[model samples]
Target: MDTDLGYWIIPLAIIGGAIRVSTPFLFVSLGEALTERSGRINLGLEGTLVFGAMSGYAVAYLTGSPWLGVLAAALCGALFGLVHGVICSLPRVNDIAIGIAMMILGMGLAFYFGKPFVQPVAPDLPAISFGWWSDIPQVRAALEVNVLFLIGAGLAVLLWWMLRATRVGLTLRVVGDSTDAARAMGLRPALIRTCATAVGGAFAGVGGAYLSLYYPGSWNEGISSGQGLMAVALVIFARWNPLACFGAALLFGGAGALGPVLQSVGVSEGYYLFFAAPYVLTLGVLIATSSPKRAMTGAPGELSITK
Candidate 1:
């Protein structure tokens, strides 16, 4: 009976982990997708994520409201993005260099200020049980999902529609594809990109909030683990489409869940290495995206990486 249960347990655990793990990816990748769509790259999102996690956790602990924590995280992320945008707008400023600096700064700030809350218990985000109808424990566990994940899913579709049908979306595309053209039309690319970057930063902050207040449910320096950096490649893989970002995030999330799922079924030997699956998958995505055979059709024209 135990051996028979293994087959059911493995797939169910992986599926559950994928759902749990993918929430952060979904939010971060959407944020990156939006920023890239505006022709700005925020590599410092890792910093934004970590710092947001800290701020969110701290606020939640103090306010006793998990929702407020998410709000705080998003606001802080927007502030970080605003700073990155302002600096990058300066003449002769390199976006990549500024991004790296922001990344380091965000992490340092999070680590330093977060030291006080390391041992304190904070409120956690709530979950909705889609599996309440099921009597089986595995099915119930696998079906239980977070509210943020639902929001992220709906947000992906909404963002996709906004990008396709909205006037602001058209303006963003115009600016991203050709800043010179935007200048000719009297549009300010700098202002537009700055605002978009801030919005993107807010999205990343929510992803951080999820990490600290939901799944792992704790404030820690190690929570992010380069998920922010990997989100850049994820945006590329999704061809900068918000809806595609959802699928790509789930793929990466599923990769991340592989190790623990395997270990749960008695495959503990070296299962720790399976934790690297997401990073390895990210490398593979980068390689596939960079292939000469791929036309790179949907990439923003003004992005330095694409150029």
Candidate 2:
């Protein structure tokens, strides 16, 4: 590799790709963080993510308003979350099993309804031009930050504060810590978990909207690329911290961008290996952060994974 210009291209490409790709992971992981904080593990977010992509794209195509499509996607995602919450609240219901079923259902529905929209062009979300300072076209393109990314970033900060400094946050922590304590304090754990799960799903929906309405700029069966499932793992790596989820998301995004970055730098040999960067990073994080004998310290007491 050329030691001068080539090195800069790879970092720039990775930076740009990280910003673009991290949006979905940020949103999905944030949602999962909240859901897990409420003592529930919702694996169906993959389904919600895909369904949101379909709904967002279809609505944008029909209404000529990308923002409206985003709203529709969030609503659809919340509905999916509600379904999971309700089913899981039942006696002897397994949340993991229900989540898996919901994931399949979401995928099936999206594929069935999204066929017509496979080739249609939906209006894309507008982007902010941070690249104007740079004269280079690639640099300019790399710096074109999406408005949704800003929103997601702001949301991460807001969520972190809300979890630490609010009464609702305390209640959620209590419920997650112990169902008996919540009941004694007159807080309804099930209701709280349901609401948290639904809100989380809504956040994931917005992430899905970013995927189709901004980056990649389309909706299709292959649009998701396992990001939803990856987001679940991201939450674990983040140790259920909302702020940490945001950071973890960026890391995953950087990993995802590795292949393109390497290719951009003219490193053609074994470039395909870089495509697995995100998964490999995820595994590495799990191994490094997890302990065999002791549970992750920050995990919620009532969470299923802990049990």
Candidate 3:
């Protein structure tokens, strides 16, 4: 490939990789967004992501149905979230500390039960080839978008609308903003937060399914790549907006794809550094958006203390 042509290919490759790699980030960030919107934070989503990957892959391999695997993953993730929610609801309990404990519990359970699935080849999720119109192999391959990506994107829109336009959304916001206010309105804050956490966990689980059954298309202990933790920062960067989560996910995905794009174009001189693109991007975004005097402009009041 010509040197100049390689430069052009880099952008296209990153675009393609962004769409594919952003799915998990989108789902996880959305999950965290919902949780935070309801006045809770689940840092353990990293463990949830890994556990979901194991469960989804194991189920898919055993059942020969990838969709079923996705379902299983969602259910398992919800269970983890439920546990976290219940524990955090207790008086004087610290949500962040509990989240870390859950993370450890989730990882331990996954590693122990996931041993049987390390070598199994699960059924892979299907993709839609939007790039079929292109005759170029690279274009066609790059445009093969996953169905889950479309689903996640649609959910983002729906979530954004729901949070801003519905009664349920209002209730969640009230509860997140002030537990006393929720009580004044005759709402059960604990119940609401628990439900929101579970829903968030479900989304994270689906993201995990996408990882093990779609892109990387395999289940292993290392499947997550810290995407779960990065999601917390991404949610902060997105200001807890579901729609913004999608856009941030794409940006992070593009950063992650940088290394592969360079290698694809015969530029492997600093391949490893490129792999750190997503992490570097996260750090930079955090530093740029953070403020000492106030929270990021749109942060949930409950989490503002972290500022």
Using TM-score, give the best candidate's number.
2
The runs of at least 3 residues in candidate 1 whose Cα sits more than 4 Å from the true structure, single-residue gaps closed, are 1-4, 268-273, 282-294
Query: Tens digit of lDDT per residue, candidate 2, span 5-106?
Result: 558777787788888899999999999999999999999999899999999999999999999999999999999999888887888999999999999999
Backbone clash pairs for candidate 2 read none
**Ranking 2 against 3 by TM-score, winner:** 2
Q: Each prediction's TM-score against the native? A: 0.94, 0.96, 0.94
The count of backbone overlaps in candidate 2 is 0
What are the runs in model 3 whose C-alpha is more than 4 Å off? 1-5, 291-293, 304-307
Predicted structure 2, TM vs. truth: 0.96
| Predicted structure 3, TM vs. truth | 0.94
For residues 168-225, could you state the per-residue lDDT of candidate 3 as single tens digits? 9999998888888889999999999999999888888888989999989987778877
Where model 2 places Cα greater than 4 Å from the true spot, the runs are: 1-4
